[model samples]
Target: MPKLNIFVGTMYGGALDVAEQVKPLFEQAGFDVTIFEQPMLEDLIQHKTDVALFCVSTTGSGDFPGNFVPFVRAFHEQGPALSELRYGLIALGDSSYGETFCGAGRALDALLEDHGATRLGERLEIDAMETFMADDEAVPWVEQWIDSQQLKAA
Candidate 1:
């Protein structure tokens, strides 16, 4: 019954919706959960959180939407400083954008990985242009991640 500190970042609300949905499920599973709206990468660097789940959307021209800029920069600049972090992530985008679909999600995952954060699960990519509910895929992905962590602990 340890706590899972969930860090969620969103743009245009889709990522937030996903985070909110996934959170209740985690809470129901006997895990104490603390949810935070991470607007910048600095939020990640500043907090000593366990099991961060980044939910982000790509903005114009492969950019992170306005709320996510600080987070992306912090990850890029000082991600390596977090030598003991563990993380999971969900990225939301439209393939229709062509030039830079899911770019923010990709960058965030890479930055976190470069810093020694163990990815608790696969990077869940949601292409809105292709599906109606990308977040639905996260259900199984997160359950598997949680189980994996338990096995590792034993």
Candidate 2:
């Protein structure tokens, strides 16, 4: 089995909380999981991971979280390409952010995919101002994503 790399790029802790919620599932599935509280894409595997989940929260006006600025930039412009890797993303945000709710996740997912990474799952987005828990929204998506990856691997 291939190791799964989880990149938690967040500001208000929502993304980190999401990662914590999903940790058990990854462990049970026997994936060697590596986490980055603050990610630098160049430092994390690009083409090496079977699946890399980027959990992020959008900041002011659809901007990248402060901790993720460098990574978001490098992953889009200066980092090693992820063409050989399969990846997924989850975005956490307040719908009040309006025009660009979950913008960070959307951008990263698209940028990575554009550079040739195979996007393996339907990227999820959750609004903090909504009526449900963010982790809850991500759980099923993660499960479905994992299942698809398993099929691909087999």
Candidate 3:
């Protein structure tokens, strides 16, 4: 089975809830899914993950959630080339924040690309002001993402 790492960056647990809710979808598609509440850069590099899904909520002034700060810092400080990494992102934020909405996820998307990681599909940005449940949008997106990537259980 292809290994999938779901790295969650949540402020009030909304993002984590989305990750948990969507995990089984990937599992049913034959992926070995693991959700990391407090993700570390080493988790990505050490595991040789086949794919990664980042479910992050934007916090204070468009910043990363506290739990995800260290991982971002480590990636900035000692991250290596990730030309082989393929990933997806689900950004949860309230659009009321204006320009900073979904900032963390957008920034992470760029950071991953900067290191040569390939994003498999367009990033999903779930606006809290618009969606009552992040997982509602996330579930269908994951289903499409899986199909678009031509992924199947190995």
The CA-based lDDT of model 1 is what? 0.72
- Model 3 lDDT per residue over 1-154, tens place: 7899999999999999999999999999999999999999998888867899999999988999999999999999996899999999999998999999999999999999999999998999999999999999999999999999887674
Tell me, what's the RMSD of every candidate?
2.7, 2.3, 0.8
Name the better of 2 and 3 by lDDT.
Answer: 3
Stretch of 10 with least lDDT, candidate 1? 145-154
Q: What lDDT score is found at residue 113 in candidate 2?
A: 75
TM-score of each: 0.83, 0.88, 0.98
Best by lDDT: 3
Give the per-residue lDDT of model 2 (tens digit) for 47-66: 35667888898999888899
Model 3 spans > 4 angstroms off:
none
**In candidate 1, which residue ranges exceed 4 Å CA deviation?**
38-42, 77-80, 151-154
- Return the clash pairs for model 2, or none: none
Query: Comparing 2 and 3 by TM-score, which wins?
Result: 3
lDDT of 1 by residue, 1-154 (tens): 5456666656677877777778866776666666677555555666566566777888887778777776666656664566677778888889999968988888878877777778876788888887788667777777776677662321
Model 1 C-alpha RMSD to native: 2.7
